[model samples]
Target: MPIKGSSKGIVGRVGSLRGLSTALMLGVALLLVGPVAAEDFPLRDKYASVGVPPVETGELAGSLDAMTVVDARSPYEYETLHIRDAVSIPLASRDFNESVRTLAEESGQPLVFYCNGVTCAVSYKAALKAKKVGVKDARVYDAGVFTWAQTHPEHTVLLGEPLQSTDQLIADEAFKDRLLDEDGFYARIQSSTDPVIVDIRSQDQRQGVSLFQMKDRHVPLTNDNRELGGLVQAAMNEQRPMFFVDATGKQVRWLQYYLDEQGVEEYWFLEGGASKIYEGMGLQ
Candidate 1:
C-alpha cells in the first residue's frame, strides 16, 4: 500500500503493484527510496538478523495481558495518542538503553515495540537495540499505533488524560483554540506585537521559505533537538506570546504540551502550517 499521506501521483505510479501484499509493497518502496533517510521510513534490514519477528495487531490485542508494550515513538507522539498501557521510550533517545533495561528488570515480561506502523522504522530499530542490550524477547508490533487506533480505538489513550473519542477530542475547546488558521496567524503576526513566531520546522524545511523571515526563532521539532528546552526557556523568559508552526502543524501540538510543562500560558499554533501559508500566498 502507498504510505499514509503519500501523494496521489505516487499512488498512481505504484498502482501496478496493487496485487502485492502490504509488506511486499513497502519493501519495494524501501528499495526504491534507499535506506531510512527520513524519520518516517523504518530500517527494516537493520534488524533482519536481530531475529525480532513481526507481531500482528490482532496478536498484540490478544497478548496484551501477557506482554509489556513500549511505544517507540517520541514522547510527544505517545502523549498525543498511543496504545493503552504502552510505556513511552523513544528509540532515538539517549536514555533508550536505560529505559529498556529498566523496563526489562521491572516487568520481566516480553516487550513489544511499535511506532506509527509498518512504514515507520523506529520500532524495528528499538527492538533491535533492546535485543542488542540483552532483552532477548524484544519484538516489533509491525502493525503499530496507526493500525491499533483504527482496529481498536477503545484501547487507545491520549496525553495521560481521560480517554476521549475522536469526536470529543475535536470538540474540545482547549484543543480547538491551540490552532490558528493562516488568516488568523497572518493577522496575529501583523498586529500582535508581543507574540513571537517560533518556527519548529526542520532546517531543511525552512530553507528558502519566506515565513522564516517572520519567525523570532527557529527550533526544529524533534525529540533529539537539544535546543528545545533552551528555546522554551528563552520564550518563557521573554514572557511573550509564543506562536509555533511545523511543516503540517501537527507537530506543534507536541510543542504546545512541552510549553505547557514549562509554565508557558500564552501560545498558539498555525493550523495547516507553513504549507497553508505558502498556498495562501501562492508560493511553491
Candidate 2:
C-alpha cells in the first residue's frame, strides 16, 4: 500500500522544547498542504487499516492513463471542478459498484477514486467497495480534486472551462479570508441588524432537527442545485450578507467557488460548521 501525501507518519515529538517556535512554524507549513491534515481525519486511518492503498499524486500525474480515474464525490462537486478526464461515479449511487465494474471491464484499466481531500473518506470507501465487487485493481487518490487542480492546472477543469491558469483556482488565502471561528460567526449574528444566516446541511444530515431553530434558510449544494441557485441569485439580487454553515465546513470550500463565481460580496463560513456550532450551543 503506497501513500503519497504525508507518506511518513509523525515519528516523534521534540525531545526538548528548544527552538519551539521554529518547529511549530515548520509543522504548520506541512499540515496546511490541504484544508486539513490527514492526522486530524481518522477516516483515512480507518480505511487504510482495512487495506485500501492510495495512489501517489505524482504517480497519477506522471501517468494519467495508468488507471481510469473516477471522482467519488457528488456530481455537483464534479461539475464544479475535477481532474481532466476523470469520470464522476459518486459512491452514494445505488449502482456504484456496478458502474465501477462496467468501466473496469470496458477500459481494462485500474480504478482510482478521489473526493475532497484527506478529510473525505468517500474515495477510500469507494475503492474498497469496488474491490468487494471484484474489480481487478481499485485504489484511492486521497489527496483529491483540490490538490489535483492546484497541482496541475493543465489537467484541471473549473465550471466547464479548462483551467488556463492556476490563478483561476481559489487560493488558500482567499478561503481563509471568509473563514470564521464560532465566536466570529456569533459576533456577525450579534452585530447585524438582520443577520441572514444559511444552513447548508443535507436534509438527512439535519436529522429533522433545525440547527438554527428553522430560522436560517436551508440551501444545500446537492446533485440538484436549483434551490442553491435560487439562494445565490437572491443573495446577489438583494446584496445581503449571509452567514453559511455546513455539516463539517468542508462543503463550504466547494460552495465558495459558486459564491465567488456568482459575485456574492458579503458572506462568512462558520469554521467546523454546524457540528461545532451545535457543540458551542450546548444542546442535547
lDDT for each candidate structure: 0.64, 0.69
Candidate 2 lDDT over residue span 205-228, tens digit each: 777776667778877665445677
lDDT of 1: 0.64
- Clashing pairs for predicted structure model 1, backbone only: 42-121
lDDT score for residue 106 of model 2? 71
Best by TM-score: 2
What TM-score, over all chains together, does every model reach? 0.54, 0.78
Q: In model 1, state the lDDT of residue 121.
A: 78
RMSD for all candidates, in order, please.
14.2, 11.8
lDDT of 1 at 182: 80
lDDT of candidate 1 at residue 9, scale 0 to 100: 19
Provide the lDDT at 75 for model 1: 50
Q: Lowest lDDT 10-mer window, candidate 1?
A: 18-27
